[model samples]
Target chain A: MRSKRALRYGLLGLSAALIGVGLLRQEHLEVLGKAVRICLECVGIG
Target chain B: MSGMRRNRIKWPLSRQRTIQLISAALVNGYIAGFQKGRIFTGGTKAVCVPVLNCYSCPGALGACPIGALQTAVGGVKHHFPFYVLGLLMLFGVLLGRAVCGLLCPFGLVQDLLHKIPSPKVRVPKGLDRPARGIKYVVLLVFVILLPAFAVTETRVTPPYFCQYICPAGTLGGGIPLMLADPALRQLAGWLFNWKVLVLVVIAAASVLIHRPFCRYLCPLGAFYALFNRFSFFQMSLDAHKCVGCGACERVCPMAVEVTKDINSPECIRCGACQTACPTGAIAGPLKKQSPR
Candidate 1:
C-alpha cells in the first residue's frame, strides 16, 4: 500500500517536472521571449 | 470490481479534476498576458488563483487580488477597486475557499509537497487560530496602507504581499518561467534572489506544515472569509443531531471549529467534516441542516 502511494506520487512529480520542462522547451520559446520582453519593458529598457 | 479497487479508481479521477483546474488557471494567465496597464485602470490586474498567487508571476492569467488591492489603495486615486473587489466578493459568496482546496495551482504544489514522506505537523488550536490573523494584517498594511500612501505619485507597483510573500508565485509562475528563459535568468538580481529564498522557505515549511501560506498570509483567503457566513455554498451543523463529539473538528484539514461555525472563514469546504460525522450531523447544500 505504501509503495503504491509512493509510485503514485512519483508519477505525479514526474509529470509536473515534464510539464515544467515542456513549458520551457522549443515550442514555448515565443511566449518566453514575449514575457522576457515585457519584464524588461516594465523595468524601462529593451 | 472490489470496494478497494473502486475507491482507488475514484482517487485518480478526483486528482485529475484537480489537474484540470490548474490547467484552467494557466489558460486564464495566458489570456490575460497582454495587459499590464497603469494604476488608474484598477492598478493590479492579474487574475487571482485562490491561494494568493502572485500578480507578477510569469504565467499568471489575471490580476492578483491582494496586489490589486495594494495598488488600488496606494494609487493616487486611493479608492477601493470596486470591480476587482466585487468580482472577488462574488466568487467568495459562491465558493468560499473551495478554490484553495481544489483549484489553486499553488495549493496543488503544497499538496504534492505534503506527499514527500516527511513528518507532518498539525498545528495546535491555541497557536493556529491567532496565527491565521497574519494575512489580515498583511492585507491592512501591505495591500492597503503601503500602496495608498507610500508614494507621492500613483506609481504602479506589485503588492508587497506578492513580491515578498507568495509561494505560489515562486513555484507556479516564477521558477517555471525562469527555467524557460535565459534572459530572465540574467535579470535574476537581489530582488529575484529574495523572492526565490522566500519561495524556498515556504516550500520547505509546506512539507511539515499543511498550507502555512493559506493559514497565515493569503489575502485571498482573508477576503473569502469575509463572505463565508453569507456564501451561497455553505456547511451547516445541526445542534440537535450533533453530539459534540470532536470528530468533525478532527477531520477538518483547515482546523475549523465545525460544530460552532461550520461556515467559518477557515473552513475550506473540503467536505472532510461531512464524511467524518458518524451521526451525519453535518450537511452540505444537497443535505438538510437537521437531516429531516
Candidate 2:
C-alpha cells in the first residue's frame, strides 16, 4: 500500500515537472500552430 | 449461443450511455464551423481534449493528444514532446481507460455500431488474447517511433498513423473535408481509397464485434490502459459480496473478466458490469481502506 502511494505520487510529481517545463518553454504554441493548420497529409490527401 | 442471449437482452438507457452521449456532443460542439464546412482554426485547438477527436474535423474545437504528440515528437526544433506526454499522463492517472468508455467520440461510434441489430461475433479467446497486444505495438511504432524517426528531407515527420491507419481521422476529418471542398475531392487517390476501405472494414467489424479498434488497434487506448491499476479512478470488486456468477464478464463489451480482474487494462469502466451486478459487488473510484 505504501509502495502504491509512493508510485502514484512519483508519477504525479514527474508529470507536474514536465508540464511546468513545457509551459515555461511555450511548447503549447507549437501545438497550436500545428493544430490550426489542416494537414492534408494526415487525411491522406497528399 | 450464450453471447447471442446476452446481446438480445434489452439494455435500457443507463447513466453511462447518457454520459457518453453528452461527452461526445460537448467535445464536438463547435457547430458554426460545421455550417461553413470548414475546420476550426481557433485558439482552443491548442488545448488537447482527453478523447480521440480529430483536430481536422469540421466541428472539432480542441486538438487530439495523439496527433499533437506525433507533431511535437516529429518537430525539428523540439523532439521531447513534454507537453503532450505530461497531458496524457495527467489524464491517464486521473481516469485511465475510463476516458475510452465515457469520454471518446470514436468510442461512442463503436458502441453505437455494436448496438445495431445484427448477428454478433465473439472473438475466440485463443486469438483474442494475443490480438490485445496489437494496440501496444501501434502506440510504440506508429504513434511514437514512426513519427519521431521517419523524417523527410525537410526534417518533418509524417503523421503515419493518421495517414495510413486511423479510421477515425478518415471518418471524422477526411470524409467531411472531401465532401466540403471541391479541390480536396479532386485530390483523392489510391491513398484516399485505401483509408476509405480501412474505415469501412473497421465500421463493419464494430457492428459484429464490440470495440474492435479499441481492443486491437487504438494507440491512445493502449497508452491509457497502462494506468488502469493505479489511476485515481478505478474499478474494484467487493469479493465478499460477489457470488462468482460471471454476469459482469458476460455483459462486458471489452471482454474483461471482471470477477477475476476488476482493474484489468482492458476494462473500460463503462459501468456495464456495475449495472449488471446483482449484489452491487462492483464499485469504482473506491475510497482507500486503512491498512489492517
Candidate 3:
C-alpha cells in the first residue's frame, strides 16, 4: 500500500517535471501554432 | 413516455449528466465562432483539453490533445511531444477514465444516444474482451506510430485518427462548419463523405450499444486507461461489506467485473456500480477513502 502511494506521487512528480522542461523548450508554441489555424483536415476536407 | 421513465432521465437529471453538459459547453465556449464560422484563434488554443474535442470546432477554446500530439510529433522539426504527453499524463494520473465518464463531450453524446430506447445489444464476453483491445492498437498505430513515421511527400504526417476516424471531430467540427458555411460546402469530397459516414455509423451504434467507440477505438480513452489502476479518482469495492451478489456487474455499462477488478483499465469510474450495489460496499470515483 505504501508502495502504491509512492508510485502514484512518483508519476505526478515526473509529469510535472516533464511539463517544466517542455515549457523551458517552448514546445507549447508548436501546439499553439498548429491550433490557431483552421485545420481543414479536422473539418473532414482532407 | 414509458421509455423516458424507464431511463429515469425525465426529472431533474443526474449530477454526472449535468456536469457533462456544463463541461461540454465550457470546453466549446467560443460561441461567437459558431455564428461566424471561424475557429478560435486565442492564446488558449495552445492549451489542450483532456477530453477528445476537435481543434476545428469553431467554438473550441482549446486544442485537442491528440491532434496537438500528432501535429507536434509529425512536424518537420519533430522535437518530441513532451508538453502534450506531460499534460495527458497529468490528466490520466488525476482522473483516469472519469474524464470519459463525467467530462468527455463525445462520451456525453454516446450516453444521450444510448438513452434513445432502442433494444440494447449485449456483446458476448469473448468478443467484447478482444474488441476492447483495439483502442490500444489504435493509440499505437494511428495516434502514435503513423503520425510519427508515416511522412507524406509534403514533408509532414497527418493526424490519421482525426482525419480517418474520430467521429467526435466529424460531428462536432466538420458537420457544424459544413452546415454554417455555404462556400465551404463546394469543397466536400469523398473524404468528407467518408467522415460523415463514420459519424453516422457511430451514432447509430450508440443507440444499441454503450460507448462502442470508447470501448473499441478511442485512443484518448486508451491512453487514459493505462493510468486507471493508480489514478487519484477511482472506484473501490469493500470486500468486507460485499456479499458477492453480482448486482454491480449486471449494471455496469462497460461490463466490468466489479468484485474482482473494480479498478480495471476498462472501468470508467462512472460510479454506476456504486449506485447499483445493494450492500453499500462500493465507494466513489471522486470520494477519497483511506487506504484499506
TM-scores, all models, native as reference: 0.71, 0.94, 0.95
Clashes of each: 12, 0, 0
Best by DockQ: 3
User: Which sequence of candidate numbers ranks them by lDDT, best first?
Assistant: 3, 2, 1
In the range B166-249, model 1's lDDT, one tens digit per residue, is 666565555655666567667767666777787788889877776787788877778777766656567778787888889988
Query: What is candidate 2's lDDT per residue for B1-292, written digit by digit as tens?
Result: 2244234424676677778889878877878766667888888887789998888888888899998998898888747988889989988888989999989999989988887777788889999999999999999999889888888898988888888898888888888888888888999999999999999999999988999999999999999999988887888888888889999898899999888888899988898888788888888642232222
Which residue window of length 10 is worst by lDDT in model 1 chain B?
B1-10
Interface RMSD, every prediction, one decimal place: 15.8, 1.1, 0.8
DockQ of 1: 0.02
Q: Which regions of candidate 3 deviate over 4 angstroms?
A: B1-8, B286-292
Candidate 1's C-alpha lDDT? 0.59
**B-chain TM-score, every candidate?**
0.79, 0.93, 0.95
Winning candidate number (lDDT): 3
Candidate 1: stretches off by over 4 Å: A1-46, B1-10, B13-51, B55-59, B76-78, B152-158, B285-292
Tens digits of per-residue lDDT for model 3, B1-292: 0123234464586677888999999999999989998889999988899999998898899999999988878887766788999999999999999999999999999998888876688899999999999999999999889988888888788889898998988888998899899988889899899999999999999888889999999999999999999988868777888888899998888999888998999998777777777777888854433343
Locate the minimum summed-lDDT window of 10 residues in model 2 chain B.
B1-10
